[model samples]
Target: MTVFIMVADVFTGAHVWQETAPRLAAAGSEVHAVQLTGVDAGRPATSASIDLETHIADVIAAIDTVDTASDREIVLVGHGYGIHPVLGAADRRPQRIARVVYLDCGMPQNGVPALATVPDQALRAQLAEWAQRGECEGELVPPARDEWQRWGSTAGISDAALDRLTALAAPQPLGTLLQPLRLTGSVVVVPTTGMLCTRNGVSIDLVQRLVDLGDPMLTALADSQVTFFELPTGHWPMLSCPAGLADALLRAAAGEGRSLRPVGAGVPPAHLRPFPLDVPELPRDRREHVDLYVPDAEGPRPAVVFVHGGPVPAGTRPTPRNWPTLVGYARLAAAEGMVGVTLDHRLHDIADYERAAVDVAAAVELARADPRVDADRVALWFFSGGGLLTADWLTKPPAWLRCLAASYPILAPLPGWGLTGSRFRPARAVAHAGALPVVLLRAGRETPEIAATVEAFVTTAKDCGAHLELVDVPNGHHGFETLDPPEEIRPALHHAMRSVVTHLTS
Candidate 1:
């Protein structure tokens, strides 16, 4: 016999699983939608003392209720804050949990609270500040129906379902989120399934990319027991498409979803690849975050400040400034009668682009302040994800800013990034880049997700009549600078360099 337990929190309950649970039962499984302590619908009075431990105990009790003699396969499906109790229960009863499902959630770490795992970074900081200030002591009231997207995407949810959600949603007990999660090492090896909500900013492909990055912490994601699935709907799949969510859940239980493997067969990691250029390495003025590659035959010369892409691992050694490709670009710029600048920005997570932008701005200021750099003539070159940083300079091109360039860039924010009202959207801001020479070195063979963003920005730039020069590397990949042969990409590299130099010098 197979037993499935459902868990969710904050303005929702087992009731949210109302539509999906029956479908699971019909498909030959016993389903239990475990209502947690303080927010249990059966109890009208919410005890302030009810915390995460209360709900964790509730799930364990639900698991224990299943007959032991029947020999059951227990699958715990956790959504949002519900994952806390599910994980807690799984930790205590690792032997009983057949599989664990992570449904549209920011993966919570052992020592962190649910609040720390929130997808919205700004909101997370705001909530933490509010809690520390003692503004929301007892519980956090549910967001209004329209504000639901602040927590997660609401793309596929219908009006009636949203109304129901608002009506049934309960105040999330603040204490439940305040306590740090404690876990035993036993739960680390549990078989896991991840159901990604593509509209919520994660997909199987994105997860695969992260796993491919070879981060030891994320390597388990590529384990054979861990599989993945993508739902086209938004965060609330149970409310949006119960039938589909039910079907996926059933498939997940059967291990019918996509399996991922780490990138180690033949292809070298993108960053570890050798720099494509054979330019003479120049001595760099290694300041803290910003590094300057001064030209040998230079007075005060034009500077091309290279901003490397990331939300790279914060602990990544030989930081961006020291990366061969970045160093190569700086040297190449220095060889072309210009100052080459590279900087380390804090883009260690998807939510950190804002802070990263600040770092970029400060780095640029630092570069311009140098006596070796001609502050009146400067170009900004961005790579990969750092391409989004072009928005600010494009929107309000300074007199000293000669040109802005991006190679294989993500100009707009992905949907799931939840970067609403953000200024880092070059696709939209390019319209304001009047007379600002914008050079884009696009990779023809870029990843589909990133390619789509590039295409959007290109279309917008053309329509808005922005001064744009597009150079296409038809056979190049995302990090083609190192991935492709030196001979193939060298011309394109030199062409882009000359273009930026012309904008700076001409």
Candidate 2:
């Protein structure tokens, strides 16, 4: 087996893998620490012009140089910002790569830049300021020795190793951080492992929660056979805890790590059971399936149709069996004495708003026709992009619909949807909603564009005298309901859920 290690920003492969590579090699595995083009010479010159593509090329070339026969099993290990290039290389040659290991770094996502992946808003702003000042010619220079010192001993790097790393550190190209990643969706099938650093007090459970919450990068990894291990050291575990990092990587490569638990497992409790709904109207090409979580109560209960959001690519389908959040919500609805229905809809790219509306209508009809559901008391629940398809219902809701609820929904027409030929302003629909009750669950830190659209809808609904109720989750972000909510905001999530259920059942 050959283990290819990718170094973090500003540091050479030798500096990053000095201790870890030897341990792996001693254990009878081949080790190759790939050096980026500019950093391979020990330091990047000020005049160097490097970007993400250059680093990706460097990784591919290293793989080619090491795996001449291409018969050996290879594990791609990337630290820090190295994950981006490693992902690009893996997407290019997924057949050759067995597993990708993210070592205390952010996971890579399609079309997301390295700079955008930085979680800290203040730091991103500072970097933007530096870029504007032409610092390092619009590149991000390595942090000074003093700056590294201020990072403190938390990373657990030895003084000698720290000195070597700082001495060898060089400027990284801004283009690498700014450029968006391009992927062909092949990398999603490859096995992934996260060697998380716990110095920031993030646990493996917290990471799993983030994945469950639909954090895009974590979700991508989790969708595959992903595993996680926590390193008690700082972000630079290769430098701080090389022996342990090496062992964890070896175990992950050998398939010794525990697989993530399948979502929506086990029985739905004594009060609820899964009921399959037949939606013959769904396109034959799409996943034609729907599940109804019917309460074990009396007949003719109020029901709610759960529409999972998408444009989930062409190949993948979102289902309650694969997403526990959907099942969880359905269970919650059942617990509240309502028949909960979840259904599969075509991707936004493949199906127009009209087509999705038809699917929703079919699901609603299925619920209405069910012996256990109250046809006149049904409600519609939309999440994320699925909200875009509800324009017609908002404009002229059916007589049987009790209310409409949307969480972190898309209310405007965006690119990639064939919306140029259609008129699909959700605000316009809201303005003509009449007296139909509408509940909107909003995340406080939602993107500016979404916030603006939500604001417009609220204002329009108010002006039109529509029965609109806004539930603002001050501490929440988008997908908070499905994603693990922080302790403080759990109550808010529950309150929002209760509010929606009340609106439907009242």
Candidate 3:
């Protein structure tokens, strides 16, 4: 029989496992849920001063309760921020633990605080500053009941459950988040299992790609002793799909889950590979290294500024202006008697979007000032990750900005990206785009993470009665503009361009 020791997450108590615990107990296994200080409903965390070490002690105690069971197998499962305590206890008592399961959370490294795992740059920065100033000694309030999505993905969770989650949520000890998770590195020998919740922006496919990158920290994830499973629900699987989680946990304890292929098993990500599109080569002038595909007919023509999606590598050659897809779009616009402009903005890292937005805005200002451009009739088309930049324009579109277009774009930050307070979230800002015509090219075959953003934007837009047009490429992939063969994608591509062109010229 397996003995399962569960650790709850931040702002939550052991009750979070109420739905899943019984199932494990009924399977002839022992289940114990650790109730860490500052998060227990009975404890009343009204000014709790707890920290990481406190939780570590709590988990150690939980482990002790089942430690005397000589005939039973012991497994430690950590969900969300609970992984810190889980890992800490496992480190101090490795000999007693058979396997450590990282449940829907990042692997906790030694000497790093749980707060470092926060996905939002703005919120993370503020918290870090507060921690530095000793302000984190106070309790950090949880998000309001209805705003659960802001905390993490709420896919699979119903409103009633959400309301309960909010009502029962505790005021977390900011110190707990601000303190480092110290490990003695003794748990290295412990086998591990991971459950990825895809709807919350993590998937085995994404993990495989990251492992292929050869990042040292992620490389260990490919080891044979580390098994993996995928759950299609969002965060809080115990609440959303408790039964499914129970079965997975049982299979995981039995070592029945899939082992990730070797580190170099997969090729580089599809986006980093060569573009598959074929477009006509055209003579174009590149001022300041930016591509300006000019029409033969006239000057002072309407220019469509093309912004490439990326936190692409800062040094990736053949910058956005030169990519075949951007090149094709620029040439297409030029062919239609309009100027198409493409510039390489410095959006090289996930956290660099804010500065990258500055670069994009500057590029647009420069495009408007160009002597050959008609500043009054310009359209801005963003691609891929660049889709986030649409927020600034949508929020307060200038009279001179005629239209906005995005092709398989990431309108909202992924739940795992830690961007709860990011201004770059276009889905939230799209409602502000009242009369500004917007065109979105959606890839039916898009990754679930990016698709979630589209779903949010579309739903919000419809609710607000925003004038939005969608071009669905039934078989298109996320980067289909460059990845799909021109023949298969041309019809949708042409329709999107025509819509933008009509908005620009009309």
Q: Could you say which candidate leads in lDDT?
A: 1
Tell me how candidate 3 scores on lDDT: 0.83
Name model 1 segments beyond 4 Å from true. 38-40, 133-136, 158-167, 208-216, 240-244, 256-267, 275-285, 295-298, 442-465, 472-495
lDDT of all predictions: 0.84, 0.68, 0.83
lDDT of 1 by residue, 308-426 (tens): 99778776666778888899999999889899999999998878888998999999999999998899999999998898889989899999999998888988886556577788898
Name the 10 consecutive residues with the lowest summed lDDT in model 2: 277-286
Q: Flag clash pairs in model 2.
A: 213-483
Writing each residue's lDDT as its tens digit, candidate 3 over 7-86 gives: 97778888889999999999989999988777786555544578888889889988888857477889999998889999
What is residue 134's positional error in candidate 2, in angstroms? Answer: 11
Q: How far is candidate 2 from the true structure (C-alpha RMSD, Å)?
A: 12.6
In candidate 3, position 436 carries an lDDT of: 92
Q: Which whole-number lDDT from 0 to 100 does residue 192 have in model 1? A: 92
Candidate number of the best TM-score: 1
**TM-scores for every predicted model:** 0.86, 0.51, 0.81
